[model samples]
Target: MPLGVGFASPAAGVLAATGALAALRAAGLGAAHSAVEVSVAQAALLTVGQYLAAATADEGAEDEGTEDEERAGPGGPPFTSLDGVRFELETLEADGWQRFWAALGADRRAAARAWRPFQLRYATAVCPLPADLAAATAALPYRHTAALSAECGPTATEVAARPAPESGRAVPWRLTPGGATAGAARPPGPGRGPLDGVTVVEVARRVQGPLAGHVLGLLGARVVRVEPPGGDPLRGVPPMAGPVSARFTALNRHKEVLEADLRSPAGRAAVRGAVAGADVLLHSLAPAKVPALGLDADALTAVRPGLVHVQASGSGAEHGPGLPLGTDYPVQAYSGLAALVTPPGEPVRPSLMTLCDVLGGLVCAQGAVAALEARERTGRAQRVESSLLSAAQLLCRLGGDGSAPSLPVCTDLAELAADPRLAPALERAGCTLVRPPWTFRP
Candidate 1:
């Protein structure tokens, strides 16, 4: 809490690879030049997009710094048990929240009072849960607490230590081909980007799926984002950029928006219309939701040959009910990332930053790009999947399962951009805008 996170360098490293992939695309296409550049400062800023939205967004009018932020307390999570085991707790539903607390003998009314704020922690960056919840956990040993969780509901993974040797060896993503005797991929059109001619229909929400689509869009792919008919609720969460939330703008500014209720027949038809000629179809729908909506991979790829279908999942959809719901925090806990970034001698915690989400997005983009390349080479790119679980494995492997080093403490985006340590990376040395993360010079 007192230091900046060690997220940017690794993310910039991924971007560098992305740039290299761009050059590879250029070379493969026999383009005249292939040059790419990525900036770490920019990558760091990208992580703060949502927070910046919360900060700069109008609350009737922009209120300056609030009271708690000035005081020194990272007042959120990674709660500790009386037995001295530290861990993060996660449960997607309110009923699960109630059950977990009930098993711990928490007051029913208090548990009910705590649920909304607890759920909003990620969005608001602070959770003012009733103190009773902590008191309940503090009274019990971790084993008791964990046993209750397993018996009833909610996931209570112990903050992990460095994983086994095999953790370091897992690939970030898996690419499965459609079939044999494939047609060669069509040449990308002259649209000024390595992926210019590619069209991607994106049906996703939150960071991972949208971020992947954002990366693809940055690479000059035509990205069409499908949202609910009323639009994503996060759009109105404040810190507006012109009309929409700055966080939304940061992730989605480059893509086209199509509002459709995927639960309806008309909505799926609309998405099918968009994907009719598209090269890629990406979604973050729940594992079963996609099939329920009649958009399963087998059906689509069968109908439209050579389509690169990427699913950004929380856990492997195939794993089914064995894993935590694929949100950023729980995945961090389940995947061992909470432990990797936890400071030595401190309780393990999921990062305030969406580390796995960002990395998952990058990995998804990487898979999509690789799939595109495979299609070009083998003429068949089929189903591709990236999960927060996989990202956590790769992150813990990349960062090691050991406790994380201390980082500079900058409370929010404003303070982060102004931190003197980041001066060299800043274009103006103090600008809110970090350098653009990627550059293509032809």
Candidate 2:
């Protein structure tokens, strides 16, 4: 994105405050050890480890290669209609996809050929849909397209052609204390770092959950990442920094790792053991997957009372499960953001930047920090939850009609990093890294 992708820039303040407070409070009270729980949902059906959803997914037929990236292609979606209307299409079911294309008069073979890339577009950042599909839309007006979407299967909406005037942003996160466990006092042992002596267990796949954990780790918490038995798939993504994916390292360089499959009994046992000894757990895996691992909130809090459990979902419960598949692009399409963030009368190009995912992480971190503070004060376990859905609403609210985004827009990550004002907050490298946004004092 052209802008700083800056919401997370402020997350540093929230984490810093809680970490420092925990350190000071622990020093005063004297304690040791802590327990934390993190849950993420990355099921294609709707959710995953919040951490992995925006990052590690390889849902397409194959990873779109670098060659695919440079191709002279329209790339995918937010497709334009025949009557001067640009629109976004969304559907969670393959049947819906098949139905939508058929209704548009696209050839069966071509629509089938397009599905893999369409599904994988978010991960690859490119979707080379067959020309037939594009031509189908071009031949018909947007109203026809919209009507077909309504009648056939997929949801379709006209992308806002102009930026709406800006006005506000919704609260980034929501926190609820589970009183499920008012069970333990804060651990003791005077420690350093704003959150010294605090421990955070992170089980995530991609950007959002991991970034939040990164902030927590920066605040001085002992952050442990739980990977599958094979380690993160992203570790192999190109542009390696040392031996791993530079992008992955940029977000996860400092954390410890524990490889285990939450799907296996041994892996579930391994996670339980880790959470028993940590102060907080932050993750974004699917809810359906949670109980299978025997790591649901009630079960885990049973193991260690007062553990802060944070779930970063694609969309919280408020939006219900029937919504489109929960991922960054779909959320952009569904949340009205694809249309809102563009310049007035410009094509609604949702910034390729991980906009809502980043904001989701920042807001989630703030919520996590607040939960930590509450845990310290009341000796009760707290539930902290946030979602890309909420972040989208928040941005739309804060952005107003979207005519003018507060931060100057930029499409290039490199250029955004190069700006003199943002340069200090970023690290120039193979993969840009956002530095801690605040400096803390004792």
Q: What is the TM-score of each candidate against the true structure?
A: 0.83, 0.72
Work out candidate 2's RMSD over C-alphas: 7.8
Most accurate candidate by TM-score: 1
| Regions of model 1 farther than 4 Å from truth | 1-6, 58-76, 141-153, 180-191, 317-322, 400-412, 415-436
Q: Write the per-residue lDDT of candidate 1 for residues 153-221, one digit (tens) a residue.
A: 787766655443456336677788885423554445554667877889999987899989988887778
Candidate models: Cα lDDT each: 0.71, 0.64
**Per-residue error at 335 for model 2, in Å?**
1.7
Task: Please report, as a residue range, the 10-residue window in candidate 1 with the lowest summed lDDT.
Answer: 427-436
* Model 2 per-residue lDDT tens digits across residues 41-123: 10110111121222322221233444533342563677778787766677767898998888888888777777766765544
Cα misplacement distance, residue 336 of candidate 1 (Å): 2.7
